[model samples]
Target: MNMAISSTPTSFSKSLKPSLPKARVFNLLKTPPNSHLRYTLNLKPPPPRLLFRIGNPKSKSQFKSHHSPIRSLFTGIVEEIGKVKQLGSDDDGGFTMTIHAKTVLEDVNLGDSISINGTCLTVTHFDTQLFEFTVGLSPETLRKTSLIELQMGSLVNLERALKPSTRMGGHFVQGHVDGTGEIVSTEPEGDSLWVKVKTTPELLKYIVPKGFIAVDGTSLTVVKVFDEEECFNFMLVAYTQQNVVIPLKKVGQKVNLEVDILGKYVERLLNNGVVNAIK
Candidate 1:
């Protein structure tokens, strides 16, 4: 009887004996080795950062394939000597002045090319309290230059236009103002400033004394040409009279000459090699 009782009770033999193996839920789904959940469940999502930006559109077709969309020709050098500080009246009577310049802001833009006293303008807008340009002057360039007799401030002389690979310097200036000259006197001549100018007896057989002249548009070096039967003076010296001033020049005042289209192509190839060496 005692043996029979042992076979059953004792909490049914401690609930069938084998307890500790309860941790096998497939070994708790097996991952733990160098853990990070087995490299985050075997990851695969990371590859995208080629950024370049600037007006971005994939670097705008590689910036339009290293740029050559052409359009680039500029020339400006008169640095300071600007006045006519306001001449309004636009919306079609055409005239929107405003130049109070001082070296025309050194590298001014907004459609560059200024050339005020010698005509050729463009600026159209600026800052630092002034720059605005626009000149529809025709009553024959407002009766042949003085920019309609300036005066609000006056003093002018600016230039900008010449990039065809530059270096031609004092010549090919197509800032195209053509005719207008008077300042027949300046004379100081030491710190330099001889000047004279006069022009238009048909630009007098292209002046020439030491040649190369531009006058109100600067580039001087004629030192003396004379030829008066009615006009073609020249003189010019240079070292800076505020880049050429004498009350912005007087003795009748007016300046802007450009003779030297390579001295009219070396005088038409020496008059066509002297008419082909007299045939």
Candidate 2:
């Protein structure tokens, strides 16, 4: 989905100057730049507000689900770290990506659904000896995801679709990216690790404390969520820090995000007034 960002016009900007609350105006005028008294006045405003959305904030979910719902489940347990061998735009304005992978290729077949950085894609071709597979991405997927920015040799988390016999290690992931988020900061907190990520306001609404979120195809529990800041916190255990690709990411690196699916379903039911109809 394309976002139309509107800049504040000269007239609107001028109007805002006088509409500041009296307390804010006094604080701004009297406080010194470096003084604690100016802290509140200098507090950063929240990130840009996005247009409200009723469906999954990530545009990938806006596409129709092609496979059966049962075949859509992913455990978010990355089977392997795949490296991009080739990535280029196709004549159709989409993209074609070939990944060098091993474990994920063990039983993979053409038409199999694979989760690459939390985005589900169908395998179009593969070479068993070379341990490589190709997937085509649509133009819409490129716009809403960070995958388009991937370069050759970039590493990505890979997972195959869940089977009934597979152990349920992580939360259910549909491989439908809700959006992309950037790592704002990372620091060690005593024995654990704390990482904060900035995201859009539309995506922030569905996030909750102790909620499930898929980051770079790994399911993690949210430690805290700052609605006003448009950011969320995640506490990482030693195992997570050692295994997931996110820990290797720097502050500015973008990560694919998939909000809890339950929130999307609830929003749909509420928006359609299904409860009222049932009554």
Candidate models: Cα lDDT each: 0.47, 0.70
* Count of clashing pairs, candidate 2: 1
lDDT of 2 by residue, 96-186 (tens): 6788999989998778889988888888778999889888665445446656446667788999999999999999999888888878889
- Candidate 2 residue pairs that clash: 58-178
Per-residue lDDT of model 1, residues 153-265, tens digit only: 66677655555665654544444545566665566645554556566566767777776666556655675666753354444345455464434544654555656667677
| TM-score, model 2 to reference | 0.73
Query: Which candidate number has the best TM-score?
Result: 2
Q: What is the lDDT for 244 in model 1?
A: 47
For model 1, the stretches where C-alpha displacement exceeds 4 angstroms are 1-113, 119-153, 157-172, 175-203, 207-254, 260-263, 266-268, 271-279
Q: In the order shown, what is each candidate's alpha-carbon RMSD?
A: 34.8, 12.5
What TM-score against the true fold does each predicted structure earn?
Answer: 0.27, 0.73
